[model samples]
Target: MAEFMTETEQSSPVVPHPGTTGERRGRAGGSDAGPYDGQEAAALLERTRTLVDPELRAALESLPGSLRRIALYHFGWQHADGTPARDNAGKAIRPALVLAAAAALGGPTAQAAAVRAAVAIELVHNFTLLHDDVMDRDTSRRHRPTVWSVFGDADAILAGDALQALALRLLAEDPHPASAPAAARLADCVVELCAGQHADTDMERRAPDEVTLDEVLAMSEAKTGALLGCACALGALYAGAGDEDVAALDGFGRQAGLAFQLIDDVIGIWGDPRHTGKPAGADLASRKKSLPVVAALSSGAPAAAELAALYAEPYVSGDAEGVVRTALAVERAGGRDWAQTEAADRMARAVQELSRAVPAPEAADGLLALAEFVTRRTG
Candidate 1:
């Protein structure tokens, strides 16, 4: 259910710890002194939207009428009343990773050839988002109401199913040698993602004390890391890379995805609603067993008991004080520190994995920048 938004209306920034990814990047060079930074990532994402949006739109346009309308609405291309709307689809990060991985390995030619695969990956991603919103009961995404909230659950689910089918169909109809393999890989990833989602929903029903930090971490990897890894692997396939290199790219993306999740979990608790498009302490209010929460629950801190007691009681509507206490308990129990430290470690591993495939710093810059942009998000 974690979605990466590139732009946010920031209230306050999340300052990185001394040895964290942001801090290291600063020491290596400031934005003016280095090519890999938020600006580079933003440019890459903008370029990716330009390349992939037309194909994505064409694919959606080919859908049958009712489904097309729902799909268009979900993607922010149209309103519920069928009026044209401004674009709010997303930042196109996953597709950008596809193109960047291809470019890193095999240059512009491979990047150009991987456009179809990029579209397919993006399709699969949006499909997940649609279903996740329904399952998570999230009211908003990308600063707007979610599809299920506006169009109802049945329409939202059917639209998501249609999108998944289109993703595979795009790959199946492609003439590239990598198409079949990419399709197979993507299908496997979908299965893993489903399993992860199941685990997440199941964990929500369990007592907080009954859920382990290890279990939550595993679920997060399956739900978030699997698709990101698949995206990079698809790009490598399109580039005709060797198995080891493809696997390395997959590892890189997976680590980065995990890092992104850790930061997202942190934001879910402490993030500003104006920037995140969600109410403050939404995760705590729902008692979601996020990474930080689980870590806090398992920390054996004195505040853990207080947190568990608070979580044991259902959150009453309008009880803002309860949410505040829960958040403070989590913070005092060391959840915040563990999550941030874990995120930095994951980013480091991501960089190491990226180097295994794209040894040249210049070649790896785009992927690194994207990874940094995601993990560094404060909202």
Candidate 2:
């Protein structure tokens, strides 16, 4: 299991290159170091995306012109004004997970059959993102104006709906044996995602003190973990993995997803905007009930009381100092420390869950590396 040293470790950061085990260990600081082998991850990502990009483009082309334009801009396939561009699309993590899971279960040769599942998962992810930007009223994503901010909310909403339909259509139309269950699983995951988003929205409407750690964690799992789990499970199904193996893969993804969410919250507070492509202290400025914020408020410490006082009032969006203060308050209340520890523990647990499905170390290596990759970034 690859879990890196915490940012607080007070050591120089070293990004390990692809090389011998000794070289990897040296850069990672120990023989047992769990670091992301970037070359391996990059190659897998590029190859998988190369395989799926054309089909994904064709899927977008099938949409009506208005929607297609919106989708293309959103995907970074075109400039906001529809001029051609090569801006990077979103990180194709979910789809890569689909192929990695399939390779783990059925070997690399069998992964081609699972491409539809990968594409379906990516479409569903973007659907949630479009609706989420509208719901959150977020003006920016990946260094550009969010879809709803550029276009109207209704257009963004309709585009999200269309994308959701496209996901199901891909699954339903695929002739593979796993298509039916994959579609069902994707639909079920969407329901959970909506439920999580609802919980999140509901919490924002209430007093910050009224939100509990358990509630926030559950919401994180639903909103993020469900889709990731479904992505892995669909891959397993395509690989002809049995129910138990499929369930284990889902568990692996779910735990890793939770860890990813935790780190994302941390990044929201302390991340450099230049690196993260979001406003500095964005979550604190929005006063959204991110995991660490809720955890600090619920910690029952004096600092928790101080943090609650800040949250009892709304966060003004442009008040950089106030957001910084709120972040410090959360840290003082042990929320940041707790989240960091929990995220590390969860990443390790994810590897254990992965082992239950693919017992072979060779088969499990890529999945393990990807799981670590989730926690390796400041962004």
Candidate 3:
């Protein structure tokens, strides 16, 4: 059994993923076998896209025409010229977790029962991204121009709002017995996401000293963890799971989401831009208070103090050397090591949480594979 850990303990030397200036990065140990081995993960993702994309596309059609076009285009369903495009879109991880959880608890036959839950979660996930792209002023996502960058901010925001409403309406209109509680859970997730985003933006505007590690963790759990938890919980609900099972699945996804966020913060700093679909050091360049940055600031090392000095002023957008040095300073301050350790620990706990809901290892292979995909990344 994994112990519940609330503090970070650390060690490591890491490199960026391959094709980023020809430097190859790997995890600390040899590869482990599972359904989620990268190749299989891609296949699982494709299978999920085939399963969920039709229903997801159908939801877009229920929107107002102009808003629907913008949303569809944002989803990589259409090109800027309003023609069909075959590009892959969002990662589809959330919806996959929902179906995987349902399958784990109630077997493959429960997949159809979980469709409404899957669609609702996926819609809410995209809605968050649409709004996030606008707020973050991100120019690109999935290597395509962001919705706000392409369609203008107001229209993008309107489309996002429409999607959120449509997600709830899907549940409310569905005849499934679990729809009402699932809808309530999704609504709660949206509220928490908003609160988390508010906390994040609020932190950015204040001094680095003003934020606490606990505060950042709380904000992260709300921002990234809440929806993931809802996605998993909705599946159990659809499977007609007991309260204990639902709660366990929720905990599994929540802890894994937190672990995923920790790795994401590391990627935001050191990950290859080619694989991540964003500029390297984008977070540092923006001076955003991401978890690693916050953790570094909270550390008491002299390097931490220096990093705090760097954050004392606004980051110049084009200062590559500054970004590189900031990343180095963060690592020296033990920020990177702490995040990696925390992520691994959380992932183990997440698996433990899964065992509570589905005791048989074979039953949880799919969900375990998904959880491993979160932490055991090469890029």
**Each model's TM-score, in the order given?**
0.91, 0.88, 0.88
In order, candidate lDDTs are 0.85, 0.78, 0.78
Q: Which stretches of candidate 1 lie over 4 Å from their true place?
A: 9-36
Question: Can you write out model 2's per-residue Cα lDDT over 1-379, one digit (the tens) per residue?
Answer: 0112222221111222222211221112223334554557667778878978998989999999999999998888888788877956666778888999999999866588999889999899999989999998878676668899988999899999999999999999999988998898899999999998898788889888777899989988998888778888988999999999999999988988888788778777776665555466888877778888888888888899888888778777577788888889999998887777667666666777787898887887777666666555543
The alpha-carbon root-mean-square deviation between model 3 and the true structure, to one decimal in Å, is 6.9
Two-way TM-score contest, 1 vs 2, winner: 1
> What stretches of model 3 exceed 4 Å from their correct place?
1-35, 274-277, 316-318
User: For residues 1-379, what per-residue lDDT tens digits would candidate 1 score against the true structure?
Assistant: 5788555542221223222434432111122323344778889999999999999999999999999999998888999888999998988888999999999999999999899999999999989999999998989888789999998999999999999999999999999998998899999999989999999999988888889999999999999998888899999989999899999999988988998898789878987776766577999998888999999989999999999999999999999999999999999999988887787677778777788898887888888888777776543
Clashes of each: 0, 1, 0
Name every residue pair that clashes in candidate 1.
none
Candidate 2 vs. true structure, TM-score: 0.88
Clashing pairs for predicted structure model 3, backbone only:
none
Question: Best candidate, lDDT-wise?
Answer: 1
